[model samples]
Target: MMKSFFKVIFLLALTTSTKAQELRFGLQPIQYVSETQGPYVDFFSTLDASTIAFEMDADSIWHARFKVALSFEGKVDVVRFEYTSEDSASSAPLMLQKSTFTFDDTKEIEKRPLEIFLYDEVSNSDWSFSDTLEYVASDFWLSQPVLLDDVEEVPVNYVKRGVSVVPVASLGLPVFENESTLSMYTEGFVASGKYILQYKLTDAYGNIIPGTSGFARCNTGSTPVYNKIDFSSQKSGQYEYSIVMLDSTGQAVAERISPFYWYNDKADEAAWNGPEVSVTRAVFENGWGQWSQVNEYLRMIAPVATMSERRIMTNLKDSEDTARIASFIVNFWTDKNAMDPLGEWKGYLVVVDKVDQEFGSRTVPGYRSQMGRVFLQYGAPSLVEERSFDGRNYPYQVWQYDQLKSSSTPVQQNQVFIFVDQELIGRQYTLIHSSALGEVKDHKWQYHLTRHTNAGPDIDATSTQYSRDNFGERISNSIIIGNQGTWFDRF
Candidate 1:
């Protein structure tokens, strides 16, 4: 019996020694507890991995309540216990109780412990658990705000809003050369607001040339008001210029740059010859068509006179030689094989008469009107597509050219003008299609569309496809002109 008992004891000791051991690590100040009553107990539970618990000395005489408030850098669970002393004054004895605590996701605890003095119910106090707990907490990740101070950079070639320069000198007897005023007029340069203008002139080598004469910059209130910069002294030479505008902020807001050349052939008579002129004088002195005779006379002198002499003599209306001069201009560009000797001259004469009847507003004749100018330049378009828009729909006009030499782009070098009969005063025509003049090369056929009411604030314009190789043959070509609506409807 004694041996069996000893064997049992040895087996029990071996079993105890073979059991698994547990190791624990913990965050300090494991838990804090506060209570309104004496002898309160608090319990803190961390992840099952590792933990350490702490409490005040159990032998202390102070009857402080253990109101427990638990918090953690990570996640944790908690419980509380209350112990009351048994007293003989009452028949029921004080008992110990327990409660579980759960917390929502938050950096701080939603509920805190309250201390109530036993003698006074109205006197309650509260304190943060972090302040009471003397242990250091782990660092947590947080978000912070950032600041930016650099200015945004944009391309120097950035085009400004509502600023564009278009072609203007498409037709007419070169008003640019005849007008006495030294002015620089750009067709499409327009601005609705106040702007300051600055300009620079440069030579062909792209270098600024000083003391070249004929340079002046005139300021108009805004663009499309026809601001003129005099280059009278700059003389007939090629030079590029840039017009820069500034906003109220002193920043460069817009720029208009282009190159132009002025050739003065007065010093070189050999180069001063103008277009060919053929004259046919009437053998009988009959003034039935005296103007015809004058035109022919001018044509005969066109190829022989110097540039200066032509400029002076062409404007001489009261000279004794006026009749002879008129005859020369009359026969200019005549078809020798025509059944009527004056057929070609008669056609052009009709054009001049039409301009006078339709567009003559000021002292200048109808040819000066935007419409008349185009009529003479292109020699009556093969087709005329015209429409009027009240406001809500599209309105346009198409002029078709079957044998344009440049490219297959329609309306490649054409111009469109918009005018309001209501505002039928000076400079009523707003020039469009100014950019089409020199930029396109493959245009053989062209179409022009104006897509808005003649009096509206906004107008949209575009061109059509063109062909070069085919002429007189029916080509699969269509041109659109309008103010608004779909492309097909524009036709």
Candidate 2:
């Protein structure tokens, strides 16, 4: 009798192991209702598998959980459970389930229906299986199954992401979606007087989910701020307005088109044409001398400027002063020449004439611009070529000075100036390049020059002299001058 009992127990264990199977599925928890309404509930009741059993800790309370089980080929698995009342009322449902199973290939069982049974319990209500359900199954080995639960509260948190502004000119007068902001700046509504509108949306846990849909609504008189959409003077047409999604940090994630209102049935059109010219003139005159000259220029030309213009101008100096100094130096050189160094000041005048011819405009004269003045002083280069070797669309100019009669290699310097109404007022200058010529003998400078502007080359370099091919391009057959002993040796 004892031996028989032991054998029966061993066989029962083996049979149980052989009959078990596993199923794999995914679960995504969702919020079905508001926290104040009650705990959200979702049911997964129509499963057809045999030998059903759930994989879960019988004791611990699961914030989110999924159900999984193993069953025999012709049997069904039943998983029945309920959330704790205290936690269910406020918390989200379980997300997935976990379980393990193994099968043996030594024997095969006939295919059969695998059924899953589910039920629920409520106050004063008898526990009963739901009948309005559907089932789907497949032939093959089962893995793990997942069951999802509904979430209660949708928590949200938002932050100010970034701020940007587009110039009114670039957007045109009929701005459609010109001003925008993320949830960080759109949360508040206006109650009276003046207020700010700021809002944000977050998940149940207060984490921001970018690109989610949500809306904010409140009466203007009840909030501290309001969106006084000033379409008062906008054209007579339909407009749109909408609340766009932001990133996890409460920044606007993408551009969106929203809804807007219309102002039809013409009322005095000229009334909304904005302030009169005389009013603007009066304001400008009153604020004119309050700022530094440079600051005033910046305010006048800059796309946007409210204050601080005077402060900036006071700290800046005029650039024409340097240009004047350069002009004086040229005059000094001309006066010192025993004979005409290059010809009468005619050569210099020719350079000035070229500058005027090429760069002179209604607003800016050729000599006033840097490139214009440089051309006037330097004369037409010996060779001029344009190339677009770089991966840029703009063509760069190359200026070659065959033998730039200078005592030393050229030292490059640059200056920038701000002008107002054709008058130079602010200047910034800096030295950018200087070729080193140490105590090494037979030092001579050779240069190939380029520039960033339209008037000059984009790249410049210098190396040993070489021969020219039939096309006059430098060939690789010439000797290096720096390696030679003296000027005579170089020749």
Candidate 3:
């Protein structure tokens, strides 16, 4: 009886293993949703087609059922196939027959979703399976190729180290899906060398995201080799792209790594529509006299100056009496505090110096930057929240002041400034909307910041129903101005 039981157990195990092998089907490489730009004429043409493999056990049923389905823009189409006589051997693997299905266009430019469903009704217990992809319409917008080193405020150039290309500074630019045509111009410094350029998307923690990597090969010719990347399939976010050039023996000779911001339609539109910013060229280009330059520097400080101080600086700019201007500069601080006038002046100088070093960009002075201007004016914020990068929203930083100098006299509480990296690039964050008076105010700031969340109304709406935790709020005309006492307390 024991021997019979053991044999029966072995047979049962064998039967289970055989049943598992009776039917199995896997999809080949399907066209990824992120890679597509416009509507596909033939969806299969974009896919890397491969045969679906099927294996059957010897005792498995010869008759089986198969099904395929496609869905797009809320529409669905399904096809069913039944196998009667066995066209494939039971003991070997067989390639299933392929099917072509047509998808009708909705005449709209939006996310077109596709889904495929397959069922094995006989050997595999008639189990159901599904896969999906999202495509866009012809109205998909593409990004114009932007040289990373040539951004408005942050321009960078590649430095040649031996045979490798290195960015002079860390560079960033907004890349869109429509700009599928990626071309890299490499000066043919190395003849007959093969270069492989690739990009990979990584989260803030630096772990690579799956299915977001691709590579292309370019052979160096007599002239500069313009290598066009096969495709761009990256989704919206920050990513690190690297290129490596190999010698004839396949040894890496040169390489470079650059950071990039990938943005979608709404984010791109917001970036393009940022406030027009112009920094005075006189700061960097003009060769003014020593006192004239000092007067110009004082004018830049007007953003943070008291009303009286601002008037003095403005008058000094037009003053021809150099001695009077010089005396006013000294008395400007001495009158405020007779005890430590020099100390106050020196302290303010230190702040200016720090702001220049920290906030100064290629095109704008430190005090001219959005953050720099606010820092100089309001001192440091009481509550600072920074969301540098997120999968959903554009990079933004929130500055909250429990008490602030809203104007020359009135003090206000619960004041805020929402600086958005509307350009999606790292530099050039602008004051999109603010709560402080005498400052640029836009009620739709919350909508642009949380566009990815879809929690608010359209961009044109003055107010959103949903408020984000850090940066969304409406300012009222009435403000609590109980204290000029605590105003300078934190300052």
Candidate 4:
């Protein structure tokens, strides 16, 4: 029998903050098998620093203390996290505090109620969280991979199986240009065998990023598998990191998956120094079908083609010159390669295939659909906020991006695209507004979103300026960029 573990409700909401009085944090449980302790679960919790109340003491130093309690079955356990201004140079804490509590069961557990409570004694404020602890019994098992900020051999209380680890307070991880590795720690229990640990990092939309997936050989004896993968070539967005344990025959025995965000604003600006290969005109004509196939390819590139190329493609639509169409296709991809240093046409071909699968309709191809066109042109958004079930607004989605990776125009950062499903079926998400330079722009976007619902006298009802946690509450009120008129002002 084979087993798989997945939690559908496991989602990370970033780019938003909570109200001043409220509290926010991330809680995760990683289960592992120990030789002496049998099976145990390590529950890791990280507190958001924004809501922590820091008071000045008699020495004029700021200090904060949070009382945390865990209740399971009929027993209760507790831990505390304390911080001081001397820890960092900022008024507020520079980093979030994380604490770990272990539950030793020594046996398999199903769905067991686990309640956690956090209280700020100074502010007289309290927050609570509840989650389930699950562990499957198997001869060969792998622990849940914990996303960590750092892992070292230094001895500390946070050290569980072996190495000391600092977990990211939040699930999202921003990848910088200088960052080289995405670190994670896991454990495996084996009866006996040679195995290979395979890892793959893919985007949130389930598309595998090129060169981000690989595996290494391992002989099993001890647990606590500390591994790192090359994160130097990734772009900005939310991604899923998955690991699979393979037997000697290359068959997968166990697997684990975790979600995190990656950011690299300057990844496209890298230098491309390599041997130049000459392009042959006949190369495109021979592999491609005649004029009919060439016409479809021309239409497919409309989302990324330049204005001049688009005008020329329009005139060349009727022409039966197969060689000329192939030339245009080559020139189109070549020009894009010049602008985009790290991206490739082959990788984009994979995205085109994905567009057909996700955005295409029976009547029209996905590339032609407004949602598909935006996706193809701008690439995937960093965070896609979908409020489909809310009765106050149409089933709309907000796709926020750090920057558009591939576009005809030179767009600025923090652009947004809004799409709404009017019919509420058939996946027909029409594009109503965008913050990009050349895409569709509707000044009355809020009016359209709230046409069915009553907006009353309160103007703030239609505004989408809520904190990062509440960013998906309503429509945007202010213009994209005020005086500049268009979002893209400079190259």
Local distance difference test values of all predictions, in order: 0.30, 0.26, 0.44, 0.60
lDDT of 4 by residue, 1-491 (tens): 22212221221112222234324344566665556655555555555555567777898877777777878655676867777774432344324444343444443455667787877766667766676655444456676676666534443766766566666665223223245677777777664678778877676446787876777665444356676677766544456778888988888987887766555434422311123333345565454334457777776777775433444666566788766666666656766677652245566667888998998878878876777877887788888888764675678789998877553344457888888887778578887777665565554566566566644664434444321222354345543311112211121
Candidate 2 local lDDT, 25-133, one digit each (tens): 2211111111132212122222212222222245654222224232423333444333343232323222222221112222233222222322222212122211111
Score candidate 3 by lDDT.
0.44
Which regions of candidate 3 are displaced past 4 Å? 1-292, 315-324, 389-392, 405-407, 450-457, 461-491
Task: Write the candidate numbers in order of decreasing TM-score.
Answer: 4, 3, 1, 2
> How many residue pairs clash (N, CA or C atoms closer than 3 angstroms) in each of the candidate models, in the order given?
52, 56, 3, 6
317-347: candidate 1 lDDT, tens digit per residue = 3356654454334332332324554555555
470, model 4: CA deviation in Å? 21
- The Cα RMSD of model 4 versus the native structure comes to 12.7
lDDT, candidate 1, residue 218?
A: 23
Ordered by lDDT, highest first, the candidates read: 4, 3, 1, 2
TM-score for predicted model 1 compared with the true structure = 0.26
TM match of model 3 to true structure: 0.34
Off by over 4 Å in 2: 1-334, 338-347, 368-370, 388-392, 406-491
Worst ten in a row by lDDT for model 2: 2-11
Stretches > 4 Å off in candidate 1: 1-288, 291-321, 327-331, 334-341, 350-368, 382-433, 436-491
Shift of residue 115 alpha carbon in model 3, Å: 50
RMSD of each: 38.9, 32.1, 25.8, 12.7
